[model samples]
Structure formats: C-alpha cells, structure tokens
Target chain A: MKILIVGGGKVIYFLCRTFVSKGYIVTVINRDHDECVRLSRRLKVTVVHGDGSDPQILEEAGAFTANAILAITPNDEDNLVICQLADLQFHIPRTLALVNDPDNEEVFRQLGIKTALSTTYILSSLIEQRASFDEITNLIPVGEGKVNVMELLLNENSPVVGQTLRDIAMPENSLVAVILRDDETIVPRGATVLQSADRLIVMTLPENYSQVLKKLTGESE
Target chain B: MSSDLRYFVIIVGCGRLGSYIANKLSHSGHSVVVIDSRESAFNALSSEYSGFRLEGDATEFDVLKQAKTDQADVLIATTHEDNVNVMVAQVAKKLFHVPRVMARVFDLKREKVYHHLGIETVSPTLIAGDVFLESITTSPIAKREGIGL
Candidate 1:
C-alpha cells in the first residue's frame, strides 16, 4: 500500500523505516530541509521538503495515489488542513491526523477527516490500561471506536480456562477470533477447548467489551 | 438597520485587520467577540470597539465554544497564519454551520482551497498585486513627456 506521512520527528523516521522494511511504498513530506536530505539518504522512501499543509506540496508528494495519509504536524491547524486537502482534493481513501490538543479530535472528526488520533489521549489511555488491566495485553479501537479488539491471557485460575468454546457463555456480539498457545495460532471453533496460557484475540462492540473481558479472564467491572 | 437585524459575529486573531474589522462591526451595533492568543493583542482595539475580548487560541474547539461560536451569525478568521485561518474557517463553516464564514489567506494557491471549501477569503497579496498591475497599465506617461495628451 502507498502511504504518505507529513511532518514528524523521530516517530516519523521510525515509522518510515518500518514501512519501508515491510516493502510498502512510503512517501514523507517534511519542512526541514536537512531532515529531508537525511531521510532520503537513509531510507528507501521518497521525501519531499515543503509545507505539508500546502496543496502544491501534497501533490508533489504523490498524495493523489496514496492509499493512506497521516498528518503528524506539530500544529493542529496544519494537520487539519493537510488531512482535509488529502480527503477533498486528492480523494485519499484514509486520512489520519495527529491532534495535538485532545479536544480537537472531535472537531477533526466532525470536519470529516476519517481518523483523528490524539497523542495525549493515546498516551494517557496506555497509562490507564497498564495501571488498571493487566490481563488485557492489548486493546485497540477499530471501526471508528464502534468495535474493540482485545487480547486476554488465560491462566490456570481463569474461570473459562478448561471450558469449550460452545459451552462458555460468551457475551453477545463478542467473538473469540484466535487463540495462541505455545506459539500455535488456532482459529477458534465451537469444538476448540480453552487451555491454560492460551492467548485469546477477541473482538466485541464497545458496550460488550467489559462483559467479554469478564467472561474470558474473570475480571470484574 | 434595526437592532434585531444586527449580526452576532466572532472574529479570530486580534491582528491589525482583525481589530479594525471588529471595531467597525462593533461601531455598527453588531455583537462582536474577538479572540486572540495573546492578551496584549486586545490593546489594538479602539475605545469605540465595545465587543468582548477572549484571550485564547482560536484553533482550540473549547475556546471557540467558550466564545459561543455556535450562535454566531458570522465568523471571520484573520490570523497571520493561513493554515490556522483555513482550519478555523472550515470548522466554523462545517461544524458550527455558521451562515457566513470568511478568512484572510496570503497565499494565492490557498485561495483556490478556500473557494473549494466554500469559504470567502480576503488576500492582501492578491489585492495589492491587482492594484499595482492596474496602476502600471493605467499610467499617464504622455503628461510626463510634456505632451499634455
């Protein structure tokens, strides 16, 4: 997939490296002339040096053919303009913006920028997750925060450890997608039995997430 | 115009142009609220300007909400930064559904973007360029040559 990233520091560099290693076509638009030169020399991605919010710069960065565009500028206004331009002018399918102020996330969403990720929100959520829920190895909001993907670790003391998938009373609208035990990935079925040390990848709606977690890991709300 | 017909306006950025517009609007009996990040910017407003002065960044939605932008009949974004003005204008127009939205953009290329987004723009650069071009084309060179033609 072709991806375009605008205006970031070390985070952008690491992201570009990772995407390049994965063989995805990556393009970066940066305002810093020296950084652009360094990125071009160090990575396989194309780097364009100019104001990312500018339509001319976006066009030069191949935004028209990009499948996804990430506006990671420090300025929230710049990020908003970049995402809006990508969506309205280039018709990019996915437009993501980095909202510096947590409150602007909703405003960005209202303006039709598909995804607005607030760095502060994400960092605070991570801290909350670590402090509150340990069994939840991973949690991610998908489909515009309508659905959640959770990873729960099952241990010997878990209530559903030895139960079969069909026998366990899973919450409504929740599905155990996969189980990873001893490095074996299993697509869960009705006959599949849960075992100790099994890592479950579950998907559920936001309303049913806590119930699903309680059922899988015996964690109470 | 009657008092009932007066518009409730929100002006972002207390720069020279913004202050001037706010002063004029307030003088005409329009309810105006001017927002600026710096408190000292309000000093630019004249004594005739009897509008509310909000000291906060206009890009933040909370500040806009505090200024009651949702109830504004007209919103003007006159920040020095074009992107800030564009963002504020878009939010005011698209999110709040303000009846009249305008911004001051300096770049000629960004004017097209403002047009596409259905926001009105006043560009000093473009206006000055047009005036200069007109002055050169309409110059009276024969008078300087003593021809009096």
Candidate 2:
C-alpha cells in the first residue's frame, strides 16, 4: 500500500520505519526543514517540507496516487484539513487523522473524514474501559466481522430497563436482535420493553460497539 | 443574553488581531472575554481594555465552556495559527451553539472548507493580497487621479 504521512513527531517517525520495513511505499511531509532532512536521511523515503494542511503542499507531496494519508500532526485542525483535502480534493481512498483534542473526533467524522483517532482519547478510554468493564461482552464474530453479535445483560442500573427498543437511541447500524428472558427467546420489536436480567442479543456494525456498550450500561466514557 | 442588551463577545487568542478586536469591542461597551494559551499574549491588549482575560487553549471544550462560550453572542477565533482558529471556531459554533462565530484564517485556500462547514472565516492573507493586487492594478489610475491606498 502507498502511504503518505504528515507530521514531524515521534509517532510519524516510528510509523515511517515500520511501514517501510513492511515493504509499503512510504512518503512523509513535515513543516520543519531540520526534521525533513533527518527523516529523508533516516527512512530513505520522500519527505516534503511544507505545511501539511495546504492543498498545494499535498499536491506537491504526490497525494493523488497515495492509497492512504495518515495525518498525525499535533494540531487537530491541520490534521483534519489534510485528511479532508486528501479525501475531497485528491479522492484518496482512506484518510486517518490524529486528534489532539478528543472532542473533535466526532466533528471530524461528521465532516466526512474516515478515521480520526487520538492518543489522548485512546489512553483515556483505556482507563474508562477498565472502569466500565463487563458492560458488554462479545458473543462471536460472524462472517469475518461484517456482522458482530454481542450479549448485553441488563440490570436495574441499565439505562434501558424501562424503555422500549424504539425509544432507546441505539448507535447507527445496530439493533437488538433477540431478548433471552427465561425459557423463551423473544425477537425484539420496536415496542419490546427492556426488563432487568434480560440478555440482549445485539447485532451491530463493529465500529459502533463501544458506543452501544456505553449506552447500554449507562457508563459515561 | 437578551437581544436588546449589548453583545457578549468571546475572543480567543490575544494576538495582534484578537487584541485589536477585543479592545475595539470592549470600548464599544460589549462584554468582551479573551482567551489565549499564553498569559503573555494578554499583554497586547490596550490598557483601556476592561475585558476578562483567560489563559487556556480555547480549542478545548472545558476551557471554552469555562469562558462561557455558550453565552457568547459573538465568538471570534483569531489565533495566529489557522488550525487553532478553525478548531476553536467550530467548537464555538457547532458544539456550544454560539449564535455567531468567526475565525481568522491565515491561509486563503482554506476558505472553501470553512465556508462549506458553515463557519464564517476572515482570511488575513486574502485581505492583504487583495490590497496588494488592487494597488498593482489601480496604482496608475491613482497616480493620475490622486487618491488610493
């Protein structure tokens, strides 16, 4: 895969070495001239020295033919703009952005950037994951995870105990498939009200798992 | 705030443009609150300015909420970096639902994305470039007729 990376930081440096060793075509762009010289020498890859957010700079970096653009700049807006330009202007297939502030991730996604990840959010979610463990359990992955089915056990503390399936704001591309209550399996309908001790069989797109988990358990992450 | 009352303006970044706007608006009797990551940037504000000064990264939700961006009638993001300005402006406009949000974008090329995203952007580069272009185009007319900047 051809990869274009934007940033002068350690993350970009490490990724450059890793991707190159794996035999992927790698290119980098950094605003710092000194860092560009160092990266060009260390990685034996093309390094363009300019503001990554600028579309002209992206064009100069050969963004058009890149399979993916990973914008890991420390500045969230620059990362967002680079990804956006790569996606919208160049029609690059995949775009990833490093979010400095986690709150901007949703907005970035809403603005049509494919993947936005943040070290701040990941590390914080790691902590949150430990605190909110067992809220959702993976049952099994069917068909190489195009469909993910999970079992969500509802307790009295669950946010959906009294609410019907229709009333609950489930994440997009997710639904309650079945409700295992005692000896009977109840196929969930919109009017089906959640009861405590109900084992919900949910089928969701894999990416929406975390949101579904958090909402089902009433755990604020 | 009530529409009949003076506007509550929140200006992020106390850099040259931010300080100027803060000073002008505060003098005009609007409630002005300026935020910058560096406290020293606040020094640029004129002594006549009597607005609130906060030192924090305005792009952060908590920092902006602390500055009461939700209550802002007008939120102007004038950070030196276009990236900062765009992020802060979006947070103010989209997240906090501020009535009017403006961003100072240094790169003129970024105006399209800003416009598409529905955030009002003032590009200093375009403003200055227009003046330079106008001078080049109109200098001959001005020299003959006598009045042009």
TM-score of each: 0.91, 0.69
Best by TM-score: 1
| Quality class of the docking in candidate 1, CAPRI style | medium
Best by lDDT: 1
Instruction: List candidate 1 stretches off by more than 4 Å.
Output: B1-4, B139-149
DockQ of model 2, rounded to 2 decimals: 0.28
**lDDT accuracy of residue B59 in candidate 1:** 94
lDDT of 2 by residue, B22-103 (tens): 9988887889999999999999999899989999887676799899888999999888888878877877777779999998
**Candidates, DockQ:** 0.69, 0.28
Backbone atom clashes (below 3 Å) for every candidate: 0, 0
Can you list the residue pairs that collide in candidate 1? none
lDDT of 1 by residue, A1-221 (tens): 99999985899999999998999999999999999999999889999999988889999999889999999989999998898788888899999899998989888888777789987877775566546678778877777567878788888889998889999988889999999999799999999999999999999897887788778778776
